[model samples]
Target: MTPHMSRKTRIAGISLAAAALVAAGITAGTAGASTVQAPTADGSPLKLSASHRAELLRDASATKAQTAKELGLGSQEKLVVKDVIKDADGTTHTRYDRTYAGLPVLGGDMVVHTAKGGAIKSTTKSTKKSVKVASLTAKIAPAAAAQSAQGTVAKSLSAKKADAQAPKKVVWAASGTPVLAYDTVVKGVKKDGTPSRMHVITDADSGKKIFQYDDIRTGKGESEFSGSVDLGTSKEGSGFTLTDADRGGHKTLNLGNSESGEGKAFTDEDDKWGTGKPDDPQTAAVDAHYGAAETWDYYKKVQGRNGIKGDGKGATSRVHYGKNYVNAFWDDDCFCMSYGDGEGDKAPLTALDVAAHEMSHGVTAATANLTYSGESGGLNEGTSDIFGTSVEFYAKNDKDPGDYLIGEKININGDGKPLRYMDKPSRDGQSKDFWDSSTGGLDPHYSSGVANHFFYLLSEGSGPKEIGGVKYDSPTKDDKKVEGIGRDKAEKIWFKALTEYMTSNTDYKAAREATVKAATDLYKAGSPEVKGVEAAWDGVAVK
Candidate 1:
């Protein structure tokens, strides 16, 4: 085999035929289609078609006022429909964001499930109590709250300087009793050049810090990894630019080693982009561009999502961010994915899985809007890893075959080990392999292991196995065996739970409930799929 072919085999795995089959199956269902039909267990088509989605959204909007009233919310509270999903049996799940007295409620998000005849079946909420306060006025001034928020960021993040944005009045109800509060956002650069966006909630009456969480979702490694690959580009003037018009006009930009601002668009003369080497600037761009396209296709075809926001609008990818910056991140404010050159600018954190991982963060923000702290934060991170692996398998690129290992190619540790392992998360030495009382206390990345392990057991079962030339030994908490249910079903259940059932405050326990509910909706109660979901979570000690 040629050097290129040899590298491809080593990176993807040993079973070329198996990889091809997986890719072919995914392609057959999604290729050349705006939306693919997903059949429930009974062989009935789920209402994911564009027309059905539109109809569901319209119905949800029309009934928002009634839903608020039905839930016994305060007169000042109102519901705004965020997303709508319908199952095969005519059950509609409408997700909404609550607002009180025209101010957004931080954790007052919920999903209302209805039967075929418009009767409410059940409802899942982030908070149970009504959103009410003695007054909307804040005794603490916005300037004072902003100053306090900035101080927290500097002290907590150890940043040299922090700037705070004007505090916005909001209803704090994610935990404990409801209260009027000021939501302040503090911005600064961390010691490692990672941008810090700390969200601080302070009591309106007491002027005390009530809650704080960082908005930055960062991943360790990306593109000199995927050998030679195809990229979607558009012709501009006489040359082609790194933009995919077919997939929401997604474009790749060159940051030129700067730390801020929108970077310049990458343009090529012959449209033949990237070498296997990293010296060429376009090489990293090629990887980033290709990764974005593959991720877009994966969601569009596999999950029936149009884009990150489900609006058919493509997001931007910024490459070469900062000098020797060894991380990549998804910024909600920019609605873009940014990548940095690793260690010595020799390796770009633009690998396929890294791209998928960062972009998935955007998907989470647009969907459940899971708070980026504690158990919910772990779920947020885990959701990205699940989809990132799924997207890798879906791409089926021989150069980068799908494996359960994340950041395998980027060499983030310099010891040639992956950043995290899905099958056995504890291999990293810090991640938890099972859910526990202390899981929420770990960093979001490490805490995500519970969900990661659950997904691996759900898709590939427990015990020892080897696929794509990599060996994995997954163990259950109780030594109970869990049978595999295939990645397709596993990912479908997760996507459904994330988009339809899960709320902002969903923890490990809540995630278990959400996935079980999602499985029941897609495959009916007591079905093997539902059983598999339960068993998988059980194996991870979620119950």
Candidate 2:
């Protein structure tokens, strides 16, 4: 379908009306009754009580003083702090795009303190407590409400299917998020006999939404009666941008070896990233859909997690973003997916495994929430690659034959060479073949080599093998033939270690311990799964 006529397009249409309501007085800006001014990522703005201001100020000044003294006695470096005061009306939170997430970002509270006097004390951060809206009750404008209600009533009064395509039948969608509004081929008129549009209302914070819209808006001659409906307006003047808001779900990009793409792709006119092409919506949709579906099925059937999170939720994909943008990535805030057209639109990164790989990062973020810096970072990257490959193996499609190379299909090197090689991560020269003190210092994409090799050995065993006609030889660091615990179990152990144990600063050694602990927790300390995990790491020389 064309972008202007898409299902989401219609639902988003009503957002204008919703924005109009904001203009009156129906704004959700009230931060419950005065919330504390602690530094939290809660989307709402912070409001400190009169009594709390002194402590907050003192602490802020103290923290600043300490930081200033650390630098030197005479310092031009200064951190300006704010103390916002509101009238009877509450203040709106300052919403910005999440630096990492693509959605609107909101934050509250920056209490600074000084040393002995007005120097510096400490710093703190916390999100605002949720606005405890006990229940959502609204007196929609009488005219608008009546018009809305009357449309439904009117639809019922004159409900009839178009006399085409075999009358009419009701079919409620059972999966995926419902769009705001759409045009059905032969949906015909509403019950009131008036033609209407369909749309859904989604939660501003989370993308969850419920279906609600005018079913009929008709006027005969001069009698434009909308079921005695009334409309209520707002006082916010106009539309209010949504904060911490997202429109859809994003999946991952699973690669041949199941490596995740980690870089900027394309940028939108608004400076946002995307995957869809400039004008080829249908082909882009098909390519992205098939790739995503293959990935979705891969994780479900192989890992048996039901879906990405073992929760059956589908991953979202965006393709052909910007004019010849290069690269793809996964961010925690998105918890979804995106793609890009390589330089000059030569390649589409929405390949099945690539999409799966990217989406798995989200699963990782939700589960292990691995920090993307050092060893854990590499493991995190490798984890995405591993699953990206696993999802591919599970998909078993034709266009993409199975292989153990990362970015083999994407043409990263422009010579048909894969981006990274798991069997010998150093095959790319940029990645490591074994763990070392400096391994943790390399980029995660390169540092990921050590674990990628471990997974290769553990899944296929350190030797030549054939799966779908592709030959792979996973070599070990010390020529020690180590046994694998199987890909299925290894993936599970890695997942558990990440989601249940890993933290932002976790490094290689810590990762080893965490994985061991996860293996022990999943399958007794000395069980086959645990043993295999140990052997895999050992094969990579991390033992």
TM-score of every model? Answer: 0.90, 0.49
Clashes of 1: 7
Model 1, stretches more than 4 Å misplaced? Answer: 1-59, 222-224
Estimate every model's Cα lDDT from 0 to 1.
Answer: 0.78, 0.43
**Top-TM-score structure, candidate number:** 1
Deviating ranges (above 4 Å) for candidate 2? 1-279, 298-315
lDDT of 1 by residue, 131-240 (tens): 88899888989999999999889999899669999999999999999999999999998877788788999999999999999888887543334555666777676667
* TM-score between model 1 and native: 0.90
